[model samples]
Target: MSVKNLLHSSKHSSKHSSKHSSKHSEDILVGVGLRHPHFTDILTSAKEIDFVEVHSENFFGQGGAALSVLQQVRETYPVSLHSTSMGLGSFADIPAHYLARLKRLTQTIDPFLMSEHACFTWGHLQGQLMHSGDLLPIAHTHNNLKRMCEQVDRVQTYLGRELIIENVSAYVQFDESYLSEAEFLTALCQQTGAKILLDINNIAVNSLNFEGGDIEKSVVDYINVLPIDSVAQIHLAGCSDVPHGQLVVDDHACPVSDDVWQGYRQALTRFGAVPTLVEWDSDLPAWSTLIGEAQKARDIANAVLGVNARASVMEINHE
Candidate 1:
């Protein structure tokens, strides 16, 4: 059977319950990044959010107002911990103390999922350990892939759970890279069992920066190349056009773009329903706006998956 048909059949047979209970459990989960501006509203409103993702570094401190807020949020919704500084692709080993701290946080939060970037943020410079405070792309070569696998293995071993690594948006390409981004990620998953947090927006952005023809097709090709089962989550966000309209920056400051929405649809068709998050970090909007974007994603996913599920059932009955 085709993937769509299989997904449709699985949805009806699956025993898992949706957050709303009224919605299909197999429908893709749609959520927004929990930012400080929307905390009060999220804590008080009667919104129907499937989940919320937070930067793991935000609540790493032992005791703080942020932790208190997260504790309260954890009480009501499923949480995904996204780490910005784990530097999984860095040549330098992740600090033992830092991993220990994250382990403690995991013990406390018991998050439903955890993720970090495929890019490195820390490296040795002039015999000193320096943090770039940015998601720097790594060369897509065999050696770098091996190093990344080692880093992911260390993190998963410490947490006793699989880690999802997100692909980073890059404007520049390295000459030393021997593999495409998709190939590197696929190899990483095969070697270390790490899953992918496929960021559709990033793919769109990189397509615009690197290749200019048929952005949607590029995204579809990228998703097709990935190991389908290795994808654990999906991220949707907005990008900004450069002054000259020559580059698209992954700023995450606006609503989902049309090209991105198209890419997301293709992803659903290829990967089926995955836990998808709507990320809007900069130029934060009202809480309702963020929720609205998530609702839009939910609608699109449901419409696509619902049709496939129904079609699959009809085929089975006819057979």
Candidate 2:
């Protein structure tokens, strides 16, 4: 079946199928990343947010005020756990300690969704473990593909749930790379039964950073080649031009650019309404401002998918 058909069927087939399919099939949700600045507001006020996402590493400790705040928020909203350090493409196995903590967090929060990047952060050199503390890109080769599949499989087994892998913004390319980003991710999902968190902002950033890249064509081609059913969520964020506009950085510090918004519209048209998130990490804004951004995303999705934004929210609540 086509991806669109599969998504539609999953929603109406049965309660069991609705529980198993991507959350988007039930409702098109738009949410904001829960940052520290808005903790007080989030805790005190009754905000109408569909969901909230957080960096998983922030809540790995045994006990703290941060965990306390997260627990409070979980009571009011469905939480998504996004990781920056899992490094599924790393050569070394994911650390046992990290996986154990992740498992504990999963059991505690029972998150609506879980995700990690398609990059590596740790590796062994001369029998010693080392970490880059950054999300480094991996070569798109057959060997790398196999290694990533193994790593993703390990993570799913540890968590006892399927995970979503997100595409990272890249400023450079490797000579050893043999496949496009879309092809690599598609193959990874086919091999491991994983899903995707398609980031439209990253596609725009990469297009500007590379030579002879056309943003519109690149975005279209990339989305078209992917296994449509593999996408479970969409991410919309802002980026900045760096050093005389020669490179674009995924800073996530500003509002979503027009180009990125247009790309997001294209994605929604092709894939239908998937749960979307508005990510603004740096230069934190007031809680109200962030909500406005999420509203913008919801409006775009509503326009593209031919659904009423307010009605969709009501439906989700009833579900």
Most accurate candidate by TM-score: 1
lDDT of 2 by residue, 25-123 (tens): 335677889888888988887676788999999899988899999999988888889999999999988889989999898778878878899999899
lDDT scores for all predictions?
Answer: 0.79, 0.79
lDDT accuracy of residue 25 in candidate 1: 30
Q: Could you give candidate 1's per-residue lDDT for residues 143-162 as a string of tens digits?
A: 99988888887778667767
- TM-score for each candidate, following the candidate numbering: 0.88, 0.87
Candidate 2, RMSD to the unseen true structure? 6.5
Model 1's C-alpha root-mean-square deviation from the true structure amounts to 6.4
Once superposed on the true structure, which residue ranges of model 2 sit more than 4 Å away at CA?
1-26, 211-213, 243-245, 307-319
Candidate 2 similarity to native, TM-score: 0.87
Worst 10 residues of 2 by lDDT: 1-10
Candidate 1 local Cα displacement, residue 261, angstroms: 0.6
